[model samples]
Target: MSALLRDVTSAVGDVPALLAIARKAGTDAPQPGQGRTARLWELLASVAAVDVAAARILEPHFDALAILSQAGKGPGHMDGAWGVFAAEGPGSRLQAKAGDAGILLSGSKPWCSLAPQLNRAVITAYAEGGGRAAFAVDLHHPGVTCEEPAWVARGLREIPSGTVHFSDVPAEPVGGENWYFNRPGFAWGGMGVAACWLGGAVGVARDYRESLAAGAEAGREPDQIALAALGETDRILTAALQHLARVAARIDGEAGASASDAVETGRSAWSEALRVRGTAAAAVERVLSLVSLNRGPAPLAFDEPYAKRMADLALYVRQHHGMRDDAQLGKLTLEEECPW
Candidate 1:
């Protein structure tokens, strides 16, 4: 494999190992009060898995390009928001803060997926200029601190939500004011996020199948009813992933761009992506529920990996801002503000 390809595979392999350690670390070690380095690493691992898989499939036709291209929405991109807000000069933006010496920050993201072990973060803040911007901050900066949160939910707690604080920690600018949200192709990452959730669901379904097979020797017969339900769930997830893959392919290929306005093209691409993500999220929920029902009380009797996978899938799927943006879909279709 080429150097880039080798690097991606190595990174992808790190996910399972990191996840194993993070899963065992319990909910308190990465305390909410801790930095999100580890959580950030988990997100990175998740992203790496998908990108590597995509690269393997697409490499036959595309050649040497990085399958997991990092646009503004890529991993570590959120910290870019810090600079966006900071450049805004001053306001109640997501990651920006103002103090006598300069803009100071002391807030936790609470839901950073790979924060527990990440060394850097693209944080957001209000700029001294009175506009929104993002900054890429080195997590090891002395003024920066991490706090892992205590509350663990049904899913994705292995990521360990927490707060990152910056006591006048200096951060460099990543983009101009409001650029983080205004940039083109910002929505692709949303779809990418959903894809990871789908993967976790697939993992659960795989384990569940194995469990069912193991039980058969004890005379457990196949339930035709549950089989159909599981099949349907699988079909939905497959369709969603297929749709997302198509979009990613198009974007990487830059298909349909030469003939159309770039903004319009990107908007359409992302809008369709959001729809697919929502569908995938729903499909995952249904699959999880169906699996639990089929397994009876046995699945819940112990905290099997699938149980944790289900929890992670549940929380991760809902992390996107897709629902609130759905209204824009109608507007896009009508070429005017949505009447609804």
Candidate 2:
């Protein structure tokens, strides 16, 4: 970790060191024909190796920074720590309204990660008439209050997950009415989360790798079934890596092509994100499940890193909506195939 990166990311546990390492390694410009995808994966892999929760906490910041830096549509008030809070559910939640008091946010923002730590957030609140709108709100304002953490899971305790109550907090609109979600980078950001999932899977797999390596050194051959399971896990991960590369290439091509066609660009980015997210989640789930079956509960019971990584990876992959998301991807993919 470099001194500068340490300084920049020190407030967030463990991420500064990983970011410093990535900076030292250097990455190509995020353009087509450049190895920017590899660089992204490189950073993600390093973060996952150290801590999955940290990666989860850090990725949104990376995405938010990229989103704002690439397109400075956000207001100047969002100059501090930022996150994207846009999870709308079938239950009660926040409502964004406009009145004499300026744009106001009321209700609870659920699943607001790093809610206690963030000073600013690029939030999506339900528009008054209909649809969604993104706003840059200051979390430090008196209207905003962090509630008790809502996560009871065994994984990702380091990344706080809870509801943030907004009691008519003032906010500045970001871009067009739906510009934030409409932006191409929205789904690309999802891919970044998948990248973290990929890294966490790799970290968990390291446990088996070391175990196998020790066996190899002793001139011993493991059972053929165990070896076969390992091989299958490797194949799954390899497939996911290739998918990521392809998605990155497509995104790079889009970025280099046009600045006007944001709708098409967003569609393409989301299509790629949904596709790769499905593949990557399945691959990670498979690797963890198979490895757990092959090795039994010994590691989970004894090894701290491996155990945590295993738990973390299991929860992280749930970012994908499973069959529903895959179904959406299939429909979009088939529609794209037709030359209209």
Candidate 3:
């Protein structure tokens, strides 16, 4: 409907199509091949934003959800993948009664990035019956509406983020009142957000490399310096991803056998990932900024992919709640510090 919504839908819609393309591009892909990787990448990319209407609406029926549930399989299935849609953030209110034939949902949600293309949304709402409850409602319902409220930051503007509104929209209960927050991997979902930022860094770095090749005749000394800076940033991001991957594997291993420990480990990993994400983002920004500052006219040019990547990367990576906080990093060391 809205231009932003159309853009997001187009972006998300590309997931299945891209996977198909990837499969065709690579003949040696595993059984289910490109589809699997595409799904994984799509999921991981979803973490780049808090809006994941599709994930929440579709995960229950997809095999990817089960694979993602395996925390031990490594962060590949969960960390960078499995966007946590209904897990956190501001709460909403729901109306459902025994005598009433249909469920009524009325509320507003902020920062629902995937709200546009989400045919259905798994949302948390205050239940008229008692406590909080999780519900799945079709987005196209007569009373349902989504608006791209302003407040979007630079770069990640493509997310199509905005508010979702429901005025007596029909709804069905998905999980229990506490189910959304108490879910095993709830906190870990937060850490996965870092992975998306990491991907953006990778994307930027790749572009930077290409730009360097094209500008070979420009000069060598400054180009070499930029390369070195990018290398360091890559190192930092790699370390962060490695740590996150390890924790994801550990969590999965523990998940089936012990839910409690799995949750704990997941939380720990989530906190650590946040710190790593912050550091990685900072590293990338440092290099990007250095290139622009020292290169002056040459590097500041916007047509190059790497030229404007920093701004987008910075905006995208900066969306994290805890990553924005300096104290959260300390919580990773002291287990008791996690409020949730």
**Runs in model 2 lying further than 4 Å from the true structure:** 1-38, 73-78, 218-220, 254-264, 337-340
Model 2 lDDT-worst window of ten: 24-33
lDDT per residue as tens, model 3, 1-340:
1333344445443554323322222232211111242333334444223223222222322322332333223323222122123433456434444336666777776666556554444566777657766665667777877776585455544445677777877766655566555544444444444555655556555555656665675664335676786577567657755655554544455324355444254345456445546655665566456445544565546564344455566665555554445566675556664535
Candidate 1 structure quality by residue, lDDT tens digits, 119-198? 45555666657766666666677876666567567554444455555666765555666665554334543454455666
* Clash pairs detected, candidate 2: none
In model 1, which range of ten residues has the least summed lDDT?
59-68
Tens digits of per-residue lDDT for model 2 on 69-175? 54565334425556788887666577788899788989887889877777677888888867788887888999888988867888775676788888989987776
Q: How many backbone clashes does candidate 2 have?
A: 0
The local lDDT score (0 to 100) that residue 66 gets in candidate 1 is 12
Clashes of each: 75, 0, 5
RMSD of each: 9.9, 4.5, 8.5
Better of 2 and 3 by TM-score: 2
